[model samples]
Target chain A: MTRLRAAAALALAAPLALAACGGEDDGTVTLRYAFWDDPQRPALEAMIDAFGEDHPDIRIELEQTPWDEYWPGLDSQFAGEAAPDVFWNHVSRFPAYASSGVLLPLTDRIEESGLGTAAYPEDLYASWQFEGDQYGLPKDWDSIAMVYRIDALEAAGIDPSEIDDLEWNPVDGGTYVEFLQKLTVDANGENALSPDFDPENVVQYGAAMASSTGQTDWWNYAVQNGCELQNEPWGDYAVDAPECVEAIQFTADLYNRWGVAVPAEVTNQPNGSLASEQVTAGAAATALDGSWTLGVYRDGLEPGTWAVADNPSGPAGSGTVINGLSNAVYAGTEHPDEAWEFVEFLGSEQAQAIAADLGSVWPGVSSLNGRFADYWAGQGVDVSGFQTAAEGTTTEYPLSLDDAAFSTAALDEFNQVWLGDKDAQAAADAVVAIANE
Target chain B: MARLGTRYPSSTVNALNPVVDPARRTRRDRSTATAYALLAPSLVGFAVFLVLPIAAVFALSLFEWNLLTDPEFVGLRNYRDLAEDERALKSIGNTFYYVLLNIPIQTVLALLLALVLNSKIKGRNVFRVIYVLPWMAMPVALGVIWRWVFDPVNGGLNRFLDLFGVDGASWLNDTAWAMPVVASVNVWQYTGYTMLFFLAGLQAIPAELYEAADVDGASRTHRFFAITLPLLRPAMLFVLVTSVIGSFQVFDTIHVMTAGGPAGSTATLNYQIYLESFTQRSAGYGSMLAVVLFAVIAAITLLQVLLFRKRTVYDFS
Candidate 1:
């Protein structure tokens, strides 16, 4: 009977023993801040120190997941209800996370803190909002620009001045197509426009574009050529619209017909996208990539070797896709007040200065534009072209609750078209169908 | 505890001999209690980690969950949706192709390497370690290196083909070649690991049996078939079952190398499941697909086990 009572006691005591082994609790409130960039860690740490000076009671932990695994990692963390107190969020992914109520709405908190949405760029302020609720505070913004090497153009006997006024039209792609042809050189030292030029033996391509990419390449062309991605934000996809299809066809023809751009096989190789790589390799003269590429080009090239240019004007106008990154408080955070206080500090002038000092991203605060440009100047990269490009017509970065699903379908279908295995129109129709579904 | 034991007296206290050897019965009861106490930790861990998660996934499959949102009950909807999903069907087809491509080549190569390693050769231990090195390397790193090796313009494979006056096709970027290239990387990484198992099986085969075959005027080839092959069936079965499961779940290499592209040529069922669950935020649909995959693997493995049960010689004697 004593043994039986002891056994019963043991059963009851087991859970208590395990429960007693829970995490150690200190007096200070610990807030976890997660982001995906490796190069910006030091700058971010500096920002954290600056925040610590103001709120010494709050301890911050920084979690850095790589770009490819960031979203998947965050999703699993959320599923487990153990997501960080605060995390970096992209505009494209914000809608799904926000709509599902896993992101803490920040409108009332911002009002209480006396910091308005005016901290972010006027255009990007609405990007982090869903259903009239602000779910994120913008951290930084990215816009598309034409990144190029000067020596490659000079070697092809093309004046660098000509590229400044280049225009594109879906009908012939205008002088932009001609510029690509002039810059493209064959193995026999013949230009793409020369009579004896061999597409098979091409040595230098005019540009490199990842066929699977949307934001940095074809989507920009499609929108710039007068096509609406959808009826509205999170509405039905209109990828099969006539203007979009024509734009995509012209984009594909840059490789298949004109042989001025690197083939899909080369551009979308697993190592990295070919544009940034080939520009460094001197195989391609130019690349159309987001402002994010500025740091990559800066780190890769010799000082003054590469320069930025505004994306050439299409018939619609010189248009580009712009998006922003934001710091969002996880809805399940244990320390909401601390997380908000830390996030609030992230948008302040001191933190934006650190972002500028890193030279990786343009600050979300437009007032710091001169500092951002000056940082690039210190690195010997002329970034005025990006500013010029930003001055032109800008399109809203497409965001949807089903962006991943739509992107997967679009990548699969359009890749075939880019590879010359399927018709562009058919691919566009297939993407549209998948998007609607 | 003593009162409880007396209430439910041991079987030793039969009706004819009621109070016989109470001390002995208590000792037996104590040993039995100790046995259960010893097993409790593993039992508790298995219940919490394995059984509960699987049960949760099964329950989750019948609902609509976006990972972040509250789950809504939508019984059988995920399964119904998967039935009509063309991409899902295609991914399953691609996974089967991957399985077929990976298993046979690796098995044959492993057997051959095992045979060579079984012989008394110079630097045998060194060769064994050298062959297994690829398995030790990370999959993501291998994918990146292999991608460069397969590059059409400046890749080592293309450069080698150029020497033979042959034009190299786009290895990973072509729809016809992508799945095979991806599968070949798996074979490259795992064949040596499989060979170690075969080598162990070969070592276990009795030397006396081979001597008997030799004295019976059997040729080397005949002895290999008559003695070595039959005796190695257990190892062969282990390798086959494991490789099949591994092939079906291949994701990291495919993701790093192709990301289910050039087209949808290399998008296997596992990759699709990952995309749906994590990227598309459709955990419920992903769980349904996972259940289907589990069923397929279970049925196939069961069939294999049944087929090999009678054929495998577990005892050398």
Candidate 2:
């Protein structure tokens, strides 16, 4: 009995004993680096490989958490005081993390390191600032643009360039509706413009617009209408403003009131496909999608069949959501200095160029934008519309302290508006109220 | 045969060997010690994974912690908030809706499958494996596939319906159908697994009971009702208790499929807890919800035990 008990104790303690003796006896330091993007993993790995050539003693371990679980996992790790030394940060999530003392303030470090920050946009760099301290540095940027079928424009007898000038309003949807009407076809071969167009049996939808986040959907429209998602940066929840509601209603009008867009039932969560998925399947001829989904289109469909276009103009004219991510150092990290060097490396022109070469996203460095654009041009796809969309008026992502709370609240409430279960105004009011609370 | 005739099956051998002599007390003590040593690892694990967490959760429910911030005591504020929270009430209602939609159908279907597969038939083993494959598949992967299948416009379900000029209802988006659609995935995945338990129970029945029924000229239905059900009570208890517990905690399928939408219609307690704790970072309220969930599960399990305690036939012999 004693032997059996001893054996069991040894069995339990064996793993702990092995765990305690981790890492080689060499005088090498290991730093854990975390990121969420899977497609960019190769580029990040190559960057780390390059980083190792200069500093081989510092072994930077890369941990890739999938997008969905990244924040939740990070939150727990933060509570346990064991988050990675450095990790990627998003605009929506950045505010919450920055407000908390868990993030290492990088203002003094940025000055001490003397890394040039002029390459990144001023606003983009400033977005990572909480109070007076810089919690992160710019990593990459993305913008929303209309991804459409070139053939659909040809079939409708409309020039592909005509889509560039399409404008919208919350009241009538403007020329954009006329364009959508021409493209939206019924099973009887009738366009939405035709007298016999059957809304019941749509063979091809003009567009896909069931995005509840609105980053790739109504947020652009809202931005175009001069409606602010937040009253001011991280100040007040203001999507319930009349202009924002109007933009939301106009967005809904496409799915419900106009009958030109894909039915919300098939497009709304929780089982809804992405805007790119709908277009890839030929369900919808076009969708306002993020530049990150460039790969989804490039991989899912043929090269010449589809093309990207600047977003349709809203009341305030040419608007899209321009968002960027940043690399942040955990405050509690033992090797904060090494983690800062990694973050500094991430923001450098060289790293940005590497990311641009992969066409993963537009690099934060303004000079490297062409490389990102050139990479796709070589792929036989004109992705300049994404750049043009941002070149015009752009709306910064609505980030706030209660972003996590707002995300949960908005998902439930806006899903109702997308499904046509609740009024757009009511949903907007409810969400704004919840967010401000 | 006699091994099956005890309340505690593992204690049968020891029960047969009585430790009556006072001189054998030390040996009994040593044996008892050995038993405790054997159970010690599992007991420690149970304490760590289950009891400690429950206690921590209960304690945390009284405080406000947002993962990033320090936990501050809020006394019964979370509970009071939960009482007034319409969303919590609705989530509970939705959870029950999911449980009701899932459990009864899954249990009955499993029972039917068990009865069919328990018999001698062609490729029975193959059929058994085929039915259990869905159960074996990961819920998240199954959910993604099922989401595609249930897509109203381009899904396989609508395509199949289109063959007969019948339009399929929006399965996951329609509030009326979302809970049922999500529950159907769980039912489909678990019914086969539950069937295996019933199959074991069915096989464990002594052949003499059926023979006795045959001599009494009892009908197959009568024999099943009297001999099969009464004798299978232990299995029924096990299946029903575990199934009910599993059903109430359904999250993965719902998480991937409906995400507690098209208007928070499919959001169950577990999903809500996750959203509050993980997504919203409402750790305190989330912990409170978890405590409520634990209590509800415990209460239901207790009720099940009480209901099944007296009538269950532990030993057919």
What tens digits encode model 1's per-residue C-alpha lDDT throughout A143-227?
A: 8888888888888887777777888886776899999998899988899889998887888899988633477778778767888
Q: Relative to the unseen true structure, what is the C-alpha lDDT of residue B280 in candidate 1, on a scale of 0 to 100?
A: 79
lDDT of 2: 0.84
TM-score of model 2 relative to the true fold?
0.91
Off by over 4 Å in 2: A1-28, A187-189, A210-212, A269-271, A380-384, B1-40, B313-317
Candidate 1 chain A: worst-modelled 10 consecutive residues by lDDT: A4-13
Best-performing candidate as measured by DockQ = 2
Q: Write the per-residue lDDT of candidate 2 for residues B17-78, one digit (tens) a residue.
A: 88688878888999999999999988877765566556667777887778887677789999
Question: Best-fitting candidate, measured by lDDT?
Answer: 2
Report residue A149 deviation for candidate 2 (angstroms): 2.6
